[model samples]
Target: MKIDIVSVFPEYFDVLNLSLFGKAQAKGLIEVHAHNLRDWTHDVHHSVDDTPVGGGAGMVMKPAVWAECLDELLGLEPADATPDAAVDTATDTAAGKPVLIFPNPSAPLFTQRDATELSHADHLLFGCGRYEGYDARIPAYYRAQGVNVREYSIGDYVLNGGEVATSVMLEAITRLIPGFMGNPESIVEESYTGEGALLEHRQYTKPAQWRGLNVPDVLLSGDHGKVDRFRRDEALTRTNDIRPDLIEQLGCKALDKADRKTLMALGWEVSGEHPRRRGK
Candidate 1:
């Protein structure tokens, strides 16, 4: 995959050169490039922002700088032309296509599911607005040109720019790539992969016994089948106790006959009380 980031703070992307991302690049699985938006600015000060047209609280990024940077890097005209439109017209389509995204606090929340979807892209491009925000017209411009433009949010909190959010998104998606992890099974067995629930119970290496605790016997029984069953059972119990909402979301799937009986024994009911459990 190829990822191009246009940002005022291009230096912040040095984080990609050190870890798993670096390894991916070295292995020729991916290529990441960060371009300074100011490099495309024509002014003496290399200015990329201007006073808001409507008199906003902070400066807004100019469309000119973004257009020039993206156009030059993507080999397209900077005059409101969409990346996709440009690619379709060109003969060289070796690098499939790219996605245009800008992270903002007002956008829909980002999640692991989003990462999973983005991992399939041939290339991804980002425009990071650092001052107040980008000129709103760019999003509409891309949309009119048939580009898949989107706004993403990391969480409820705000950041100075989309740089950190890009890092978060990149790491999450890269980890999902095949052969990226030391143990592939770790991805499936992990929490929120299959069951959409938190991780199953865990018992770690020890002296068999800790300060005042002991590893569950099932874990040490040396029976693979029993160990798997024990882990699933514990996961059910833990999730039900601490995050019942998740169990509620799972509905009937959250409980089998044996688990339902067990819940009944613990004063739970499908209809009697515990309104949360009643409908499920």
Candidate 2:
């Protein structure tokens, strides 16, 4: 996959040159490039931001600068472009399209599910916004021209810019690419990959006993069936104690006879909203 990022501080992307991302790029599993947003400016200072047009506290990234950068890099002609529109023919494509992503605090929360989908895209273009954000017209204009564009947030809190968020997202997506991981089964067994979409169960290494504590007896029993059940139970217990919200999201769909029994033992209703179990 081809990944392109446009940011005011391209050097911020050096993080991509480390660890898995670096190895992936070197092995030709993915391509990553970071461009300076200021390169599209014509001014002597090459500024990319300007005071808000109306009344606003922070400056907004200029659409003109972004327009040039995007049009030149992705070869997108604005919906309103004239016959003489400045279009880059070398990098442009009719069938080759890119998904445009803008990271914002108000956007839909990014999840492993999103990472799974993005890992398959042919091209991904990220616009790392700063200050207040890019001009609202940037995404609107791209969508009007038939481009696939989306805004996503890593979480509810705020960040200085989308640069760090981009790195976080890139890592999640790139690591999912086929053959990227040494053990593919690790992906399937991860916390949110399947039925147990909750926190992982406690893990134990060699020297089963430490101090006065010991590994769960079931784990050392050599019975795969019992071991799996014990792990699932532990996973459910941890989720209930820590993030019941995830269980709530899963709803009744994630429950079966065994799971319902576990919850009942913990003083939770099998299918009711109230904590106290309703007499079934």
Work out the TM-score per prediction: 0.80, 0.86
- Candidate lDDT scores, in order, read 0.74, 0.81
Off by over 4 Å in 1: 78-95, 195-203, 207-214, 237-245, 251-276
lDDT of 2 by residue, 127-183 (tens): 999998889888777766666677899998999999999988988888899977777
> Best candidate, TM-score-wise?
2
lDDT of 1: 0.74
Q: Indicate the TM-score of model 2.
A: 0.86
lDDT of 1 by residue, 39-98 (tens): 988989999999999685999999877877766765665454544553331222223667
Clashes of 2: 0
